[model samples]
Target: MPTITLSEATFAKVKACAEPLVDDADSVIARVFDYYAMHHAMYFNGRLGIAKPNPIRLPIGSRELTHTRLLTATIDGRELHRPDWNSLTREMHELARKRLGSFEAVRKVTSANLRQGRFEENGYRYLPEVDFSIQGCDANNSAESSLRLAKAMSISLHLTFEWRERDDASHPGQAGMMGWDPTSRDAGLMADGSSRSWHDATKQAIERIARDRPRREFTLAELEALELGRVVKETGSKGATPEATLRRVCQELRDEGYLDFLDNDGTYRLR
Candidate 1:
């Protein structure tokens, strides 16, 4: 964790809030932050105190977001009108640049490596106006990027993502094609929320490849052939666009340092 300096009065106040036997300074701070995450707070008698949650807020459930689209984001109660992932990424990077006092400082952290400074290699595009490199225009990627930046800058954010609800007969009791748990850090939630079936199918195929392949290298065709039936059974949907999903999965895995894309012909190998 990064070191932060606190005044003697503030430190004493924080110590007073700690648990008798179990809470250390770090734990106390974390506990306070956890409480703040769930509840609204206001100034009471010149001191901050818990307040009621805002009456008007987005319908973001406890579950992680899946198959969703970016609509707007409210940061520390200030709303930003970002219609798409590209706009949101640009906005967040620009905000970070300004706060840090230089684009070079921001780049040092976000670049692929300090030595190479390969921003584009990491799916980022340089913005001349902001003097920053923003991530690719992907809803989940952009959301994750913004969340990461907020954490680093100690800023607060509440994102609103929209998705079309699935038909009752097709999905039954679910709001959309799939449900996501909001608290999960895993990309399982909200990543490919709009087309969860394809996402799941691609993951399923990848799992089979990792488990069954001897050489650990396979083409897209082999994945489709081996796991199509199982993927259908698991997701309750056929592979509508296997090629596209495969490409998406490949890129995701590559970024995660799990697989290496071998060729334009759709061959990939586990690393």
Candidate 2:
């Protein structure tokens, strides 16, 4: 079991915060990631064996570690390029744009290892397998905010960590972090004050996601591939000429209740 010890002052503050929420005294204040690791908050889709991967990157400085040591020290110790964190962050940013999308900035939220100015370095970044998805948890603070970001961003959001807000809610690992009761179901989406499938009213939302895509168009093959691949590609690139006939065709088919593979043909087509 992994445990973290905090300063007495921080502990006291977190304890005070947890009092109104639970029946027992909370010992560990966790982050979104921590709560997830401890199995406090859970997501349903993981049981289905669906996983998406994400990279964890943090910034560190030269003082904390020498450039030579970082560059050469493998988990076992070996020769490599610059060991400083700034270089690592730059590399990770490139990876994110290439794999996820161009707009998923890797700089602002990155971390660094600074050792009293011995060297100015940033954090390290690497890709890991992730299930579900990522979304920029925006203005709201409840668990509902997480789902909203997932839908609106049209991307998978790792619900492990989110921005902390005293006004709305605390960060996932805060002293009084909210947990999902076993009986709670995923909050259904709404529009016009009615519950609907995620596919409902997603055209505009999907379009917004496409705005961030680097490609100007997707081919017929690409469209089906994305769908089957559990990706969220859509047909709304800015000023796409002729609206890329293939994408339009796919959207039309999808909109008309045609989203299954034909048993006989082994291909997706209109119902």
Candidate 3:
């Protein structure tokens, strides 16, 4: 995703929007919730290193709710039954309580993720990219809007801050990423946007696309081709043969189909 500038008006409207729950939420958390609803896995690398991307983490009950809505036992070719929110929430809340009780310092809690970008204590990050919503609010940087939110909400929740999202949306009061982060290459990132770091945004994008359409494998070239809707014209002097690029793409990406692409013209999309 190219950088998008949230307009001052949009910020105002967002702030003016009512809180999602009766739970204690100042403007800061409220805005965070808004963005979270839009993008569970978000990008929020802060220049000060205080901010990081944190994906949402759901209470298992919440997952069951999700399972109810998205998962049809017969669809995945699995043999089993599904339940509803009422049944799942019954136990999910208890599980969340038990899990939180096991933690020591409540201060250790963080809502943002690390995989979306560089995380620091300055650098800790979060994962799963779904249980949370992480994005750069640059609140201090967004002095103008920050003031508006503060004034409207009648609180001092931010000194210029960023919004935090997590997958555990149903568990609104829960704090922090569940277990820090997964120890895997999925935690990597690319500053140039050229490399997908298994961050929250990419995770959400992949899920949304997969849910909405036929899931398949493709490369950047192919995805780009697919997104562009087939080629009408091709450019560039055609320097070095793309063979090297294609070779590397095949080697480095998942063989599952990261490099496969669909092209009509120059336009391409992941198949």
Residue-wise lDDT of candidate 1 within 122-155, one digit each (tens)? 4455666555455454344556566545544556
Regions more than 4 Å wrong, model 2: 1-96, 100-188, 191-271
* Candidate 3 lDDT tens digits, 251-270: 32223343343453322234
Report the C-alpha lDDT of model 2 over 52-94, residue by residue, as the tens digit. 2341111110011111111111111222243222222233333
- Cα error of candidate 3 at position 250, Å: 5.8
| Candidate 1, run of 10 with poorest lDDT | 54-63
lDDT of all predictions, in order shown?
Answer: 0.50, 0.29, 0.27
Each model's total of backbone clashes: 11, 32, 45
Q: Which should have the higher TM-score, number 1 or number 2?
A: 1
In candidate 3, where is summed lDDT lowest over 10 consecutive residues? 59-68
Candidate 1 lDDT score at position 14: 88
Please say which candidate is ahead in TM-score: 1 or 3: 1
Instruction: Assess candidate 1 and give its TM-score to the true structure.
Output: 0.38
- Alpha carbon lDDT at 22, candidate 2: 22
